[model samples]
Target: MGMMFPTSLIGLSFDRFWKLKCLSSMGFQSLTSLEYLWIKSCPSLTSFPEGGLPSLLLHLSIEGCQKLEKVCKRDKGKEWSKFANIPCVEINGKFIYDPDSHSD
Candidate 1:
């Protein structure tokens, strides 16, 4: 088997699990079944893969990533627009883009 498990992982909740700090890379390439992702205080993480996350991912939480600029951007094409409408991603305890907020 691979370093982790198979592709089907629904309702998976990861909270403050400090072990992630040592992991050089997190391979979720085939986690097509993942629905919810919760990550916090991973100070060493720089970025996720460049193709965006699984289409089934509903809720995503990322915090304390002081070095992260863009979460996931398409390597080619106009795929950046695909993420323009998704509403389930939460970054730094706020919605990805809030019209009323000046921080964006």
Candidate 2:
């Protein structure tokens, strides 16, 4: 696990990370109970943790992370498969994936 992520946690918030760069994929996948992940203002972040996110993750939000935002290009993202099962996902204040919002 990196400095911010630990194992078997319920949820975590990544806020205004001015110096954070990258994360290993293995660490976050071990978070069995992790349901929500919030990332904000990490300008230098170019990618998600390498492999994938935890299976139990239900919500994901990304804000002010331009580089990472480009990588997570909606369904075309490099890590799109990792996000497929997630019920909700947001990027730059927009909902990339939200099952409930399609009620129109």
Candidate 3:
């Protein structure tokens, strides 16, 4: 995957970033400056890698990815467990079920 930062980007409070049919299986990583990410119609993308983004990420949108089952799976002793407090994450435009939730 090509790793090149766009030249026009400055004062990076990006409200939206869209990638369609171009993102590889690797997925975009380390976009710490991005606020909202829109990934659509990328069928090959199955799962986001563990520890994929900066902790500052606020909004994430995933849609039309039929093959994706989970956004990020918890790997024991991995940073995926730390995302419980990241504020907002949506899968297929629906709120994700908190893996940490329990029934009593």
Q: Please report the candidate that would top TM-score against the real structure.
A: 2
In model 1, what is the error at residue 65, expressed in angstroms?
A: 1.5
Candidate 2's C-alpha lDDT?
0.76
TM-score of each: 0.63, 0.79, 0.53
Candidate 1 lands at a TM-score of: 0.63
RMSD of 3: 6.5
Worst 10 residues of 3 by lDDT: 9-18
Candidate 3 residues lying further than 4 Å off, grouped into runs, are 6-30, 70-85, 97-104
Candidate 2: the clashing residue pairs are: none
- Rate residue 72 of model 2 by lDDT: 78
Q: How do the residues 61-96 of candidate 3 rate in per-residue lDDT, one tens digit apiece?
A: 566665552434323323346444456755566655
lDDT of 2 by residue, 14-96 (tens): 88888777666766766878999999998988767666787888889989988887777756877667677788888766687
Query: Candidate 3: which pairs clash?
Result: none
Provide the overall lDDT of each model, using Cα atoms, as 2-decimal numbers. 0.55, 0.76, 0.48
Per-residue C-alpha lDDT of model 1 across residues 1-104, encoded as one tens digit per residue: 12664687865544554435322224566778977777677665555545665678788777765444243332222333534445576667776555443142
Score residue 14 of candidate 1 by CA lDDT: 43
What CA RMSD would you report for each candidate?
5.1, 3.8, 6.5
Q: lDDT score, residue 88, model 1?
A: 74
Question: Which ranges of candidate 1 are over 4 A from the true structure?
Answer: 12-26, 69-85, 102-104
Q: Give the winner by TM-score: 1 or 2.
A: 2
